[model samples]
Structure formats: structure tokens, C-alpha cells
Target: MSERKRFYLTTAIDYPNSRPHIGTAFEKIGADVQARYRRMEGYDVFFLMGNDENTVKVARRATELGLATKAYCDEMAQQFQDVWRALDISYDYFIQTSDPRHHEGCRKFMQLVYDRGYIYAGTYRGWYCEGCESFKTETEIKEAGGVCPVHRTPPVERSEPCYYFALSRFQPALLDYYERHPDFIQPEPRRNEVISLVQSGLQDVNITRIGQDWGIRVPFDERFTIYVWFDALLNYITGIGYGWDEERFREWWPADIHFIGKDITRFHCALWPAMLLAAGLPLPRRVFAHGWVYIKNEQTGAVEKISKSLGNVVEPMEIITKFSSEAFRYYFMRECPFPGDGEFSWSRFAEVYNADLANNLGNLYSRVITLILRHFEGHLAGSRAWEPGEIYEEQDLEATVQQVQGYIENCEYQLALQRIWQYILDPANRYADRKEPWKLVKQDLEAAARVLFDLVESLRVTAILLKPFLPRTAERIYRSFNFSRDWQQVRCEDCYVYPRPVDDLRCLVRPGPDGKLAPLFPRIEIR
Candidate 1:
């Protein structure tokens, strides 16, 4: 077998201005799935996430909340950690930009760029928003609107002496990087956007903000601190010990993927690679920008963006409490393609939960287990000496298995799941139609055992493939069959081990009238 490649993945470090919503949660979950899948494939994986804590937005929010900036950021950061935990997000490192180690790494990176002649000093005159902490051009700002588009607050016009990075110096190099590495920014639309922006022109970007005492001090000048993007973007490198530990840094630099929201694509796709090139560091392999979720009125077809001010923001915790984290994860991925907009509605959520989880998967599991319990005294039948199956069944099952592997490898999880369910439905229909068990109870007990064994083996395969998405549900199914629940313990090609019959085996989920029904997903009435 060939050696497995190492994988490094990251989510955009969230700005800790407020608690995260479902938008941020989706990105984290997507990265988590990718990391978990890589690990399952025997690849070394590093998944990094953290808060972007150094910004005028954070500082002002801290003051408004009547606490020191550090304390305020610390408090908000905890909310992110709590949300990640509730969602069962398995990250290798949860890095906070406020950590002293990160501070040291950021400083070292800045020093490297400065030594390369990419750094200069200049005075910036533009529409500055204390809320955004960035200079915005007049054309970029809305003419009729007083507030910033992002922060939705008024801008503060100011001029200050600051350290600047000669971004124009890397224009040719950045364009070349894009030409050579077309996959660096994902989805043709977003990549074309970046290309057009780069070709239009580049400008010298201010790297430091004067009077921002809350941020890291510039190496030579106490009056200036690193700009928000320059400081925040470094979290990806610093979190992995970019400058502090040479050996550790070498292990996971140049992330395989950086999953970010569409709004911040420019910072990650355009500026980040340019900085890495200037410093002779590796550029990220790919940057995927996902679309925003919008809330729409069912009757009027009116759509509005989800946000705090609009009172439409869907909190991560609220969704987790209402539905299992697995359900939330599955719904988001299945509802839309990875790179496109997806609409969210209470009705749509209910429909997916009831149809996919409760009715299809959960209901099928209950029926199979219940039949095993009722017919064979609640214990799986003994393994019978086997014979080869009909060519059609064997071929169909092999095809489905191969499809499962393909979808997962390509990161098309929804398709993977659809394929797994196909295995379940096909077997369930075959078992019901055979009626071989009824005839075997008297004269053909061995034939009955063979039929039942095939069903149980199908369940085992389903459980193994479904673990990454619905871990808890998969575990329950494994326990119902009295089989080992650990994915590492079972090989995909291994024949299912028939558990010795136990008199007290019970169904994990009760079934309904169509079979034996249980409420895997109880109806949730949203307020």
C-alpha cells in the first residue's frame, strides 16, 4: 500500500465580538468532518480553530460591556469553546490569539516580513470605522448608509501614521501563484472574483494601527500595533507553533484546507498567500468559501439575511438543544451543496428530521432488530456454513459498497449517506418478500438463519459507515446487535461476526405500525 499523506485543516478563526451563530458552526463542523475522515483513512491530521481576539471591534465591545478588553475577550472565547463542545467538534487544537505563545509567533512573523523589505511606513487617509478597524473607500461605502455594511455602524474618518506592507510588491507573484495553483481558491466563481480583483490592481496595505493599545506592540514603534487582518490571519500559523517550535511547526504547516465564509474570502485567498510567499512560507492548499444562510418568508417569498439586529440569527446552542448535533450536522450538509446558498426554515428542518432520521433510518433499524428479537428469541442466529449468493445480489451489494467509499473520499457526504441507505432498503425489502423465515421455522431452520445473518451483516456495514456523521445513533445500533462499536476494530471488508444468542436482547428503538415505531425524532415546536 502507498503511504498516506498528512492533512492539515482549519476554520476561519471567528471574531469574538459575540456568540457564534449557525453560520460559524457549519464551517467548524465541515472542517471537523474532513479531519475525521482523513484520520479514518490513516492520514495524520491537524485541525486548528480559535478566536480572532485582537481588533477594535473586540476592544470597543469590551468597553461597552464594562470589563477589561482581555477579560471581555476571554469571556466571549469561552462561549465558542462551549459551543464546540456541545456540537462534539473534535479539533486537535483550540487556539486563542490572546495566548502568549501566539503573540510571540505573530511578532516573529511580522519581523520576518519587515526584514524582507515588504514593510514600509505611511499615513492612511480614508473612511475608517472603529467598528470595522479598516479603511474603506468611498465607493466601497454605501452612499445613503451611514453605518458600515458589516458592522452596521457609522464610520469614523481618521488619518494616522502607520506601518504599511507593500502589498503591490507581491502582485506579480500572487498572480503567478494563482496561475500555477488554480485550486488554491475553490469554486470557479470565487476564484474568478479573486483573479479580477488582483488584475485590477493592488495597493500598499497598512499593517499597523496607531493608538490601538489593546493589540500587540510593533517591534520598533510603541505607537503602532498590527492591523486586524495581519494579526488575525497569523492565528492559523501561530496556533501550530510557526516560530516557537521548529519540529512542531514543520509537522503541520501549509494547511490542506482553510474553510471560511464567503465574506472573508479576500483576506484568506488574496492577502494570506501573498504574505506566505513574501516570508518564504508554504501557501495553503485550498480555501473554500461557503455561502450565507438566509431566512425566507414562506408566503411572500421575501428573503432576509440572518443577523442579530434583525432578530433572525439562529444560535448554535438552540439548534443543538432542539435536535441532536448529528441531526444538525446532517441537515446542513444535505440541505445545500457545499459552495451554494441554503435556505433554512422550521418546516424544512422538521421535514428532514422526520423523513430521514425518524422515519427512514431509525425506523428501519428498529424493524430489523425487533424481528431478530421476536423470531430468534432476542438473540442473533448462529453463523451457518455459507454458500455464495445469487450473482445479482452480490454484484449489487458490491456496487453499493464501492459507491459509499467513493462519495466519502470525494467529500460528498450526503451522497455517501444516500448510498448507505440504499443498502438498508434493498435488504429490508428482500427479507420481507422472501418469507423464508416463516417456512424455515419448521423444515428449513438453516435457510432462515442464512437470510437473517445477511440482514445483520448489512446493519453492521451501515453502522460503520455512518459513525462519522451520527456517532451516537451508530453506537446504539452496534449495541443492539451486540457487536463491537469501535470503527477501528472492524475492517470494511470483514464478514460480520454473528453474536452468540442471548435470551434478553432488546431493540434500541421501538418501531411504528409500518413496522415497530419509536420516536427517534420527537416533534419540536419552534417558538
Candidate 2:
């Protein structure tokens, strides 16, 4: 009965040059998990994701395809959204940087920062990577042995007339801000890296590019277009009615978290906040720099970045089609550590799927539901009086819920899932094995009913905890029983803090053509 607090989060907009790989989807899935968790905690959440279309690659790729620039961006945007939707990324808005409103807002913001003396005209000569569409600093080039770290290719030296943002001027202020807010850059290692970079020195960055007409133009000078990074970063504000809807923008301007990849922490944590400070806007509360998803060379036992040249890039849709949205979500969130690097291999995927989902969680669900349906015709007598026992004997219910909550709040997704399986669900499976509920039904009818009640309770608890991570599967699990509360209305703390009592206590899931409830997670065959 209190007002729901607001939570706004955004992921880095991807370049529309190519289809998104599993590596790209990794970041979105992590952000979606957090967004869903916040909603479950009763926050008014807004999730934003999009494509960065105002880059040189956009036009070049479009030209290669023989399509007009805008048409290409539109088509790619649809393709990107389709993949994200199919993966069940619950983003509220998808901003295309080429939108008229985005262009208008970017121009206005640039002009404001320009008038404030942070912007100046200059000539920039630096190592440039055409793939990333940005200038690389000497430090970056040297560390990576005279190549752009991301592209892993030598950056061309070029000179161009441009407008620069006076980022060096904010050096002292940025350091102070970091000192004051240690939590601004998440996962400790990223925070230290950002601090070290800013402490080394800040450089005034080129904000406008000449001889480019595909991007938003610098308002005062029509001859130059805005740099893609500068333009792309504005998506967070512009996507949420920044220049157009003042009332709406004010409500969500200072985002709770900017969910970006570890590669772009410098952009989000340093350049982004400085730009906001220049415009006198509040910075986003936190920037979470999540790790990458690499492809494991199963034979060689080596791990490498997902790249087309490497011939190891795995598309998100490839796995989503092969399995399911929930299965896709579960594999990454379970196998991959959220704040660190993870590897994906077909054999590893099958192993995790069968061990965690099929053998443990799904197997438990089928046996419990089937046993209840077969013996009691899907109704358990006096289930309302059933004192649902502990899913974990070592910890009480509230303590158990708190432990999972702590992992989620810190974005320790893999750990949270491990806790669920190892503590909550594993114990439930153990309980079934220990009691042998199926055999009890043949002799001790009343005792068997009690055992089924506890198993069903375990499933209910499991569903509530998994709702945010594995949404569709969670809904299916929750809807199988006649829980008193509505599925959507359920919250993370509901499992312990205020568990609603069961009512009719009858199986609500529809039986398949085989006259039996289908398996929630069918065992994946390892070929």
C-alpha cells in the first residue's frame, strides 16, 4: 500500500552492422533478470534496449545490401527486436538512434554543452578503428600491441576536423565523484580499472565528425555530424522522452542502472557521467559492467571471443530455436557468472541442461504432479491444513529467501541459481527420494497425501524464486496448482514473508493428448 518506487535501467545499444550473437544476448539477459527482479520487488521498472544506427558501418552495410540507409536501419531494427523478444528480454522501449526525436534531442543536448564552453572545434589525429567507429588512445593501442583491443586489428592513423567535448576539464570532479560513490562502477574490478584510467588523465574527446551525413548533425554547424558514441549514449535520455516529453523525462532521467558490457565501462562510467555533469543533469545511479560470453573450443580446451573471423560466433536465435526461451535463459544465467566471463559449448550446454533442469528441477515437477494426479485425481485432501515443511533443513524459510535475495541484489545470478538448485530444489528432490511417496500411496494412503502436499509446496516455492529468471517456465510451474494469489501479482519475498494459503488445492494444468501432464523440461539429447 505504499507507492511503488521507480527503477529505470538501460543496456548498451548494439551496432546494427550484424545480427546479435549469444555474446550480445548475454548482456541483455542479465539486464532482463535484474529488471524482472526489481518488478517482483514492487518497483515501477522501465527497461530500454536498442540499435546504434548512426555509424559508418550502418551506411556501408546498407549500401552493400543495396538498400537506402533509413530503410536498412529500420529492417535491422526489426530483426534485432525479433531476436530480443524471442529471448524474452523484457525491455520497455527500443530506441533507434536514427529516430527524428533522437536526432532532435541529441542536437539540442550538444548545443547546450557547446554553449557551456565544454565543446570546441579542433583537428583530431589518432588511431582509429573503423569497426568500433571511435578513436583509440595510445594506452589502448600499446596495451593491445598496436591494435584496437576489440577489433584486434591495426587502427589507421587519420586526421579530421571535429568538435571536442572538454572531458579533461572534469578530471578532478570525476575522481572526487568516484571516491564519494564507490558503488558507481560495479563488481569492484571494473571500479578499480575506471578509477585508474581517470586518475591517469582524462582527454577532451572528439564529439563531432566531418564529412559524415548519416548521423545527427551538430546543430550550430550543419557541416558536421555528431560522433556515433556521443549520439549513441544519448539514447538513455532521448528514448524516454528527453527532448519531447519534459514530464516523462523528469520522471526517469536519473536511471537506476546502466547495464553495459565490461568493454564499454569507460564510456558509461566516465564519459557518460561527465557529459551529464556538463549538462547539469543527474548521473545514473550505477553502471554494471558484465563480462563476455566466449565460445569454448571443446577439443582444444581453449576459450575465445565470439567473432565471425574466428568462426565461433553463436547466434542467440540458434540456441533459442533448438531448445526454448526458458532453456536459453536458464543455461546462460546458470552456467555463466553474471559479473565475470563464461564459456558456451554445445556439449557443456547439454550437460548443464540435463543435470540441472531435466534431472533436478523438471524431474521433481513431473513426479510430484503425476503422483498427485494419478492417485488423488489431482486433488489433495486437507492440503489447506498441510504444514508445508522445509525445502532446506539447514535454514528457515525467511533466511533461505533472504540468501537468494542477497545474490540477486548484487547481480550474482549464477550463484542465486546454484543456491536454488542446491538448497531449495535439491532438498525437495531428496525429500521425495527419502520418503518414497509413490510407494506410500499403495499402503498408507493418508501419509502419501501428506508427502505429496510437501512436494507441491516445494514446487510452489521453486516457481516463485524462478519467476524473474525463467519466466515462461516459472508461469507454467505456478499455474499448475491453484495457488491463492495471482501469478503476476506474486513477488520474490512472497515465498516466506507472506505466502498465501492454498484454496482448492487441485491440479490446474491442462493434460496433453497423451492424457498426462507433459514434462516441463524434456531431457536434451547430447549428440
- Window of ten residues with lowest summed lDDT in model 2: 386-395
* Model 1, position 408: C-alpha lDDT score: 60
Pairs clashing within candidate 1:
147-153, 510-517, 510-518, 511-516, 511-517, 512-516, 512-517
Q: Candidate 2: lDDT over CA atoms? A: 0.89
Candidate 1: Cα lDDT at 347? 76
Tens digits of per-residue lDDT, candidate 2, 210-275, equal 998699989999999999999999999999998888788998879999988898999998999999
Candidate 1 lDDT for residue 514:
70
Please provide, for model 1 over 170-235, each residue's C-alpha lDDT reduced to its tens digit, 9 standing for 90 to 100: 889988989999888876788999999899888888889877678887776778888888988998
Each model's lDDT comes to: 0.74, 0.89
Return the TM-score for candidate 2, rounded to 2 decimals: 0.97
Q: Evaluate residue 86 in candidate 1 and report its C-alpha lDDT on the 0 to 100 scale.
A: 87
Number of backbone clashes in candidate 2: 0
